[model samples]
Structures are given as structure tokens and as C-alpha cells.
Target: MIVTYITNANDECNTRDSRPPKQGLSACGLIGHQLFFHQVVFCAALPDNTRMQVSSKVITGFKNVLLVDYLAARFPYFSAKKWAALVTNGRLTHNGQTATLATRVRQGDTIIYHMPDPEPPADWVVPIVYEDKWLLGVNKPAGLRVHSQGKFIAENLIYYLRYQHQPPFPDVNLVNRLDIHTSGVVVLAKDKQVLRQLSADFAAGQVTKTYLAVVHGQPAPPSGVIELPLARVPGTKTARQQVVGAGEGKTAVTHYQLLETLGADYALLQLHPQTGRTHQLRVHLAAIGHPIVGDGLYQLNDEDYLHWLRNGRSPQQMPLIQRQALHCAATQFTHPVSGHPCQLEASLADDMTQLIDKLSGN
Candidate 1:
């Protein structure tokens, strides 16, 4: 389980630490997850503690790549934990086994991606808390992606399923996506028919979504509402979503109540996004003032922070919490086909919880 940043086919350097990693689709204008075609460079025998220079073709499959030990069931190579290091890190563009001492080529096949990645094993058995033949539901962890996108193309929950379990869940699909930085319960359709039904319901606004977030500052009161139209301001690519004039924006709304204020500087919020917009929770909150902690994209840039203040957010405070602190805490909707109501939610993951605890202690 080596943590190496992919520069190309040859040069890969190890990171200081593998914690608090960073990516995916066009979420908030992000590179997001896109799949790539790759090739395998065969190795004769397990090198004696020698690192192999992976071909660039395979490395391009992921963004901010990390080389991991992939415990391939299909290929016998290394121990599972060793492989989990890289696999869990969102690395491993391809899975291969060590060529037998007397063998020739390894299991290097050009695997084409279906625009989706594997799902985490934990989520699979997490309890079909509520399930039917048509749909399956489980609480998704924070830092997990619903589909393939930039740095997380195939290292996420969706990809994990195909990698680990290919039987009962031969076809896994996400009707909607939760932010990679957010955590909560998500629903998946086992087949294409169920997928279409659920997708339609979402488009018709027949679905219900709930989220929780830890913010930099406390809202003045226990609860409040935000009505802001959001839009992409051209010329400012790679930045926090800017608040714009009505004519230049799309309709977005959020209802949030302070669940608990850690102090004058921090608060826990129960959020509900009325409309599904990119960075909806993060943008709205930033427009109001508080930015999610560790918001690498938005807060990472001071100019974007300034732009947020110019939007609807009060200029009274700068970003404190970073990252898109918003999480998809819960969701409810009638089964697209079954008509039976379904609901699910995920608890705070280690990263979020640890961040909260560390900051609170500070």
C-alpha cells in the first residue's frame, strides 16, 4: 500500500501522509471522475522490494493517483490488506496477478470503464437496511463518490462493488450523486429499468433529500432559510461558485437549522437542499458567510472567498471550515417501480468526525 502521486507513466513520488486526500466529475466544475483505457506491462517475478514503473496508460485512469496493493480475487498476487492500501486510496487502474515463476504474460486486459466505479464492500453488507428486487439502499460514507469522476474514477463505492463482488450485483447504478466530501445514505437500482424509474422521479422533484454539515460559524438563530439563485460566472474557472445577478443565475434554495453550535466560531447544521445544484449547500452557505472547513477548492483560494462575500454572503467572516462540509445525511422517495416508500441515512464518517472533534478541542 504505497501512496504515490501519479505524474505520468514513469515518475511517481510518495506523499508525506495518505490522510485527507482529494476529486471527480464536473461537481462544482471539478475534473470529476472519468474513466480511461489502460495496458499492462508484464513483470516476470515479484521484484525483491523493487518498485515497478507503471505504464502511463494505466496511470491516466485516475487523478491524483496512488499506487495500491489490489488484492485481486481474479488474480492471485498479494495479501488483501496490502492491496487495500492502494485500492482504498483510489489507485490501481488495473488488477493483475504476479506471473507465475514459470508463467508468461499476466492477467493484463484492457478494461473499459462504463463511466461508473465499484462500491465499497462495507456499504454492500451495511444492511440492505431496506431493499427489494428493484432497488437497494445503504448509508454511504463520507469521502465516497457515487460514480466515476476525476481522482476518484474507480476507487469509490460503485467501483468497489465490481472489483470485489461481481455476482448478485452485476449491474450497479446511481440514480443521483452525493458530493464526494459529503456523507449520507444513498439508493441504488439493481438494474437499468429501476434506474430509469428513480431517475424520472428525481427529475420531477418527487424525491426528498436531507443533509448535515459542520460550519465555520453559527447561524444567528436555531433555524433559517436561504433563497438564492445560483449561476456559473464565466471567466472564473477553477474557483468557488460565485453568487451572481438573478439574470445570470439558476434557482437554488436551502433550509438549514442549527442543530448545535459548538461555539461562537463553529456550528452543526441539519440541512435540506430544496434544489439539486452543484455545490448547492456549500455555495449557499458561503453566500451567507460560513464556509465548510477544509473546502480546498473554495477556501483554498482567497479571491474566491472574496467573491463569495460579494454574492449574498456577509463579509463579516472569512472561511473557517473548509471542504464542502455538507453531507447527504438522508433521502426518501417512493420506490420508482415498487411504489413502496424508502428512506436511508449515513452517520458521520471518520474524517468528518475527527475534524469536528479536533476543531472542537481546539
Candidate 2:
């Protein structure tokens, strides 16, 4: 089990500066901060060795600060009290030595931690869409996370495929990721070479992705391109992306074609994202007059959204659909090994289909 940490702190949007940096734009554009997996720790037990995977990070920006404080600041998933407890229990170390609560850390210091294994959720299902010797594709359900993060480790798709699925695929690696609420076809590589090739293909804009979305209103133009640069909204409690001036944010482009109109209130759209910015589809749709149906985060005010989250994400809060009505309909790419064209697809999720049916009064 190998643990990797993303140490690019400038990608964060929490700072007062609203302008994105000139370089190092990751795959997700300005919203890379929300993709922070610095603190997430996953430990897999080997059959013979039972070796523990330790997550480590090298400090770069800060001067002499208490170790507990640094952990709390860098990894907001855990509180200071929890970090202190971990320090006391010897789960954390700095510079190859056990760290104490009062240990002061400085620049170039390395912090390592041994986290506990995760317990996956029992009631979950992921349907395989396509499978070959080199690759695997699955129709990921809405509300199912693609990767482990924070407290939700084993319940994610990768963990399930590695440990729970029959004829386990312990070495499978994700080629792309989708939001938890977005149901879609997710591609996974069976080996490292395939993973690298597929990942590079995605990063280089060589992959063509198609999506289906149910939005609140019909766009004026039946088909058009949304050429909007996106930047992270700073000074907000939660991470959010917004359209910025032409040269201010990272370039994000999405082409959308209206498919069907559901009465006068809603419409179905087919989307082709030219760039894979975080929440690009949803943000572009919302930037126009049409926000995706059941998108509580984008449609609702911050206060209301927080209230809904606090209330356990009840379905009552969103009546149109349970989750965002976005589905990754298809993906087209070249097979890394065979050098053949590959196109994989997933049907719309049940909830979105049911909502469409109801809107059509069928």
C-alpha cells in the first residue's frame, strides 16, 4: 500500500488572494484546494507482512510552530484535540522521531503518521460496465465516493474493488474521478502502465467525455459553448468555484446541447466538457440561467445548503431529485495497450430517470 500526499499549498483558495497562480494548475483548475488529500491515510494489511502504510509530508511554508497546531491547520479534518491524542499515542512523528504535543516544527521538517484501517460501508453496489484484461469500467452510483477521503475510506469505490469484489483487483488504479453525487461510468486501469497512459491521456485533453444533465430552465440557444474561466471563491467557509474575468482564472470550456424540454420548467442537456475543471459542468450551467436540478450546493444559498447538510441531507430539502441530476453518459478514448479506439457508456441513474418520467407525466 503506497500513500501519496499532494503538497501544493498555493492551490488553496482559502487565502485572501482571489487570483489563481500563474502556473502549476492541476487537472481540476482553481478548485484544487478542495481536492486536498493531504491528511487522508489508508492502511492495507498484507497477507504475509501486515505492513502499515504511513502518510508523510515535508513542510515548506511555515516557520517554528507547534506540531499540533501545524497538524490542525494543515489537516482540518482532525481537530487539535484529536491531533494531540494521536501525538500522545505515538501515531505521529517529526523528522524520524516521535513528536510531542509541544514539539515545534520548522521549514524542511517532515511529518509522518500511521493511521488506522478503514471500515467500508456494508450496503453498497457498483455495477461493472465494461471489463477487459487491461481495463475495467463501472457505472458508479450517485452518492458513492470514487476514492477514500477523511472518514470515508473503505466505503469508496477503490476500496470496494480492491477488497470486497469477487476476484479482487488489488492493483487497480483510477483513470478519472467523479463527484460523490454524480453518477457515471468510471474507468480503472488494471496495471500501472495502463493507469499512467490513461491518466496522461485525460490530462492532455485526449479523452472525450459526454454527460447528461437535467437543469431547471431551458437555455436560450439550443446549442452553444460556455467559455468561462473559473476561480475558487475565497473567504468562504466551504470551497466554491465561480466565473472570473477572462484572464483571471483557469480556462474552462464546456459545450452543451439541449436534448429535451420537460414542460416549461426543466430541460435535459447533453454536455461535452473540453476541459476537466472541478465542477465545470455544474458551474457553467449555473453561470447561465439554468442550474442543474437537485444541485443544493450550487442552487441554494450557503446558509440553506449548510442547514440541509446539518439536517442529514434529507430528500425533503430537494424535491426535484434526490441528488444532482448529472450523469456521465459516455467516454471515448484510445486503448493504451491495443491502440484501438474505445468508447464506454453508462445509462442515466434511476432517480434521474424517474424524475424525467414524472416531468413528462408518463
Candidate 3:
């Protein structure tokens, strides 16, 4: 059965369906003018002949605002030009009347607009290593974005999960994020409460994360702690992080132990980061002059890194590895719903495994 709700700007909820409550659905919330049933509602298994009617009331804040401007401001995914086309095509409605570009919106007016389904990548898939009613753990592949960002909205994991997964949940949230080039176990929450708990656990340093990395040049002393502050590189739009002095940047610490040497120059290391910072591991390693193998940004000089970004990845230009050779091998945390200990592990991706084999002459 399908469930529908009408939510107003004042956060009032009104359900207009006779569907029985499912297992986990709890309440409704409104973002912009889109009416969404949150927590534990599922619209799946609805009969093919049934039609869905979902809408949200225009917020009461704007007074005498153009309908097009209001829509563009509220839903940033769509541009003003797109909104014009939608308005011209009679696809938008204001209080049950056809909405045009000149239609002025008043407080509490209902604006209804439908968004086209996102065309997610067809071949994108991740292996589900562990799953329960509250959470899902997946071995996410390298070179895959965990969520929509930059120019990769439709090619990300969340979009694929929503469109391709069978019986999709009404709400699915990512508890932790992995870099696009970092292959590892990614945990997703099926319920919002689980998300909050896991988020708090991560914030309080209650979770233990382990990563395996292959870096050029064996680190001296075998194992040690690298405590360094990290901050964004000065005046660069490339999202690069760098190690700074104790007086500046955020405090970041990583404990690393050299596992083995790959031939003469390279080494395999196990990393345990005490604090989570953007590019904490990579920046710390590079700061100590032992950048991870195939890390384009951290491994190269600033000039070379920028050049590589502009020229794209070519074997001649990037002879070592096409992507960073870091894998999130394991994570330990308390299960939010079960209230029990949980451990999740993902083996090294084929690229990292093969790179190690090649370097070790196996």
C-alpha cells in the first residue's frame, strides 16, 4: 500500500491514506515544498494502478514573491531557466490553479511541483557485507562517490540505492562518508534514530577504524604516532589539506605500524587515526614525506598535482597507481539498535591487491 502526507509550513502533518502502518515508519517532515514521509514509511508494493499525490505548502515567510524565484531559491537543484520551462508548460500549480512565472506567492500558499526521477548510473553496485533493519554495511568500490557531490549527483551510491534497491526505505542516511577513491566498508542507516546514535558514537571517538595503505619509502622507526594539525591548503580550490604547526589548524593524530616491506622502496602500513580530519591520514603521511602510493594530491608537489588535475590521468603522467592505494579494512562500533558490539571488515579492492602483488613480485 502507498502512503501519502500533506505537510504545511508550520510542520503540521496530515495523512490522507488508509494504509496500515508498516514496521518502522514514524512521522512526516517537509523540506522546501516537497512533502515527504519520514522515519518508517514505505510507498513500495503499491498496486500498479494506484497514483501518488504528494505536495507541500509554500512556506509563510515570503510575501509577494514571484513563483519562479521562490521555486528556484527553495529547490536549488533546478535553475531559473528550468523553472521557467516548467511554469510555461503548465507543470506547476498554485492552490489548485495552473501556476505561471508571474504568479506571486503569498504566505501559506500551496505550491505543487513534481521533479523528474533521477537517472542514476545503471552499472553502479556495492556489495552488502552486513545488514539489519536499522543499518546496512557495504563494501563500497573505489572510484565511486558515496553521495551526490560536484558533477556526480546521478552517479553516486545513494542515488543508485534509492532507484535500484528493492523495496527502498522512506529514509536512508549515510552515517559515515568515504572519499571517492577510498574503497572500504561504508555504513548506512535505514532509520534516522540509528543515524543519530552512530553519528554521536563517531563524534565521541567511540568507534575504532582501521585502514591499510601502501606508501612509497618505508617509514622510519617501524611504528609511531604522528600528531599534527591539519588545515586547508592556502588559496587553492582543489580541496587539498596540509599539515600545520600546533598553533594553527585542527588537531589530528594518527598511529601507524609498518606491517611489511614491499620489495626495497615501498612498505605496507596499518593506520589507526585518533582524530578524524579531512584527509587526516593522507596529509599526515605526506607531511612526514611518505605519501600514500598513487595519491595524486598528497603524493605530488603542488605544481605537479595541479598539472595532473588539468591533464587527466594517463599512464605516462601517472606511472605509479591510477588512484590512492588505501583501503578501510575494519571498523568496530556498538550497534545502535541491537545494543551489542559489531565489527565490519572489507578486504582490499582488486586494484590495491594487484598493486601489492606486483610490488611484491608475487
Candidate 4:
């Protein structure tokens, strides 16, 4: 225990400025007085590996706080790159006593942060579609996650499915994932046999996947195949994909056949991806200057959109609805168990159908 000068109760404190604490009325000096106060305790740096476990007694008003929490609450980006240098050199106050971060925090002391920090919320849930002893397929919704996360990680599709139901089958392995922004079909395997079989099948092109997309503009011709090679963009860990030379990137071929034209700005098209490159459909569409509507990562400029909107065009003409106007509608594969050809199809989900009708007035 260390000697401390406690701050008098009824004082509102803010760490807006990192200044020294001024002397204040003492709790010990007043006899027979049971007023609440801020206690300051600083411990010397003892060990490198031992983490400073922080648990505090309830002090009602001032509350419990750590040095990191204190500073992070003030300067959000409290790091060398953002504002760490200034904050690192700052001090805190105990009662009227200003103290450095090295000052130990006792029962009722407050730690001040110059910058406030809030953790960005990362959340998602994915829904499973098909699973057998060997194979599992998921109708991954847009914004659903496949794996664990910080607070919201366990709530993702895979976690939700596994947690909600304790199925007889063991750990279900996801062989693939659709982009969190792309709502579509995903496949999983429960066991190594099924995984190997499905992996082999997918590699051998035994799986035929078909998708429906609403593009930004009406495709010019009757219909055509977009066989552009694709390349994953650098720097971005994910979500940025483009077309590039064969040796430079993977050969991503998409055959886009026009399903119907809503107007001058939007067209409903069926997409057949011959190659399983990442973001194949979106990249192919964007490469043709007909990026999907609401593709935030790409298509920021509305010049093409504005030109058409100025001409009394909305997705009504092109029928580019909200979100990613793309959906995995069907998949075809031969059943490993029966050795018979099987096809699975999902009707347009409510969101897709609703958006389609809402925009096209269908």
C-alpha cells in the first residue's frame, strides 16, 4: 500500500487536458468524516512477461480504469502514427495530484485518455443449406460470417449453425466461402472422404454453378461470354479483384447471357463462371463498365450513373436493384453416394425477388 491523496467527492473530472494535479482537500485530514475520494497508487515496472491484471473495487462515481483504457477513451488512434506520442507523455491526476501513466491506480482513481477509442463492430451470420455424411452446402447470405470474430464472431453463420444444433455429425468443414458482401451458395464437407471427393470434383470441373446478376447498364448485345482473366488486387487483404494477363493472374472466365432487359440502365443477366477465381462475376461485370449497383468497393463515380439518371434513367431502365444484384441460383453435381447426377436450385430469396420486382416494376 502506498500513501495517497484522495480527491474530495462532488468534483466532476474530465481528462481533456493532460495536466498535473493541483493539491486538494484531504480525506485523512478531516476526522469523523466519511466522504468518498479518488485514490492514486502507482506500481513500479516489475516484470516484462507478467501482464498487469486489472480488477478494481467499486468506487461508485469515478469508476475503475486502466492506463490503456484511459488514454484510448480520449485519443481514438492513440498510437505513434495517430496521436500516441503526445498521449504517451501525458499525465493523470489523483485528487489534486497530477501523475504519470506510471502512477499506480488505486481503488477510486480515474485514468484520463486524450483520445477516445471505440472498437468497430464486426458482425455476421451465415445460413447452411445442404449437408450429408460427407458434403455440406450453405446458402451464405450477404453479411453472414463463416468463422469466429471478436464479440460478434461466434454469431456468424457457421457458429450459429453449429451452436444452435448439436448435430450427430462431427465438425463440419467449410470448403469454400462467399464474400461477406456477396450472398450466394457455399459448400462444406463433414469428413475427409467427402472433402477429398468434393475437392476433387470441384477441381475436375464436375460442379456447374450458375448465378443471376442485375448489372448497372443494359448489356449491349443479345448475349455474350465474358472470358476475361482475373487478378486479385494488391494491398487489400480481400474484396478487390480485377482482370489481368494470364501469366499475371488466374484465368477467370464468366459467360454472361442476358436474361432480360428492364431498361437502358439495368439488365438482368445470367452468369456462368467457368473458372472459380475470387470475385469473378463482380470483376467481370465491372471490367465491362457495367458494375453491379451498390458495389461499395468499386464504382464510386456516378458519371455513368449520373448521365443515365439525368436521362430519366434509374435501375428502372437498367433495373440495377439495391445491394449486390447477384445471387447463386443453381448448382449441379454428381452424387458421390448414388453416382447419379443431382442438381440443386434455390428460388430467388425474398430480398432478391423483392428488389427485382421493386426496381423493375415486375
Instruction: Give TM-scores for every candidate, taking all chains together and pairing residue i with residue i.
Output: 0.59, 0.78, 0.70, 0.58
Q: In candidate 4, which residue ranges exceed 4 Å CA deviation?
A: 1-129, 149-152, 166-170, 235-238, 301-322
Q: Which 10-residue window of candidate 2 scores lowest in summed lDDT?
A: 24-33
lDDT of 3 by residue, 148-232 (tens): 6522334666655664556554456778888988999888898877899999999888999999999989999999999999999
Best by lDDT: 2
Per-residue CA lDDT of model 2 for 153-240, tens digit only, reads 5567777777677877766778999998999999999887989989999999999999999999899899999999998888755667
lDDT string, candidate 4, 178-282, tens digits:
665567787766666776787788777778988988777887775788878777677653347778876778777788888877656677789888878877888
Per-model CA lDDT versus the true structure: 0.56, 0.77, 0.74, 0.55
Residue 266 Cα positional deviation in candidate 3, in Å, after optimal superposition: 0.9
lDDT computed for candidate 2:
0.77
In model 2, residue pairs whose N, Cα or C atoms come closer than 3 Å (at least 3 residues apart or on different chains), thus clashing, are none
Candidate 1 runs further than 4 Å off = 1-129, 150-153, 166-168, 237-239, 302-323, 355-362
In candidate 4, position 176 carries an lDDT of 58
**TM-score of model 3 relative to the true fold?**
0.70
- Pick by TM-score: 3 or 4, better one: 3
Please report the TM-score between candidate 2 and the true structure. Answer: 0.78
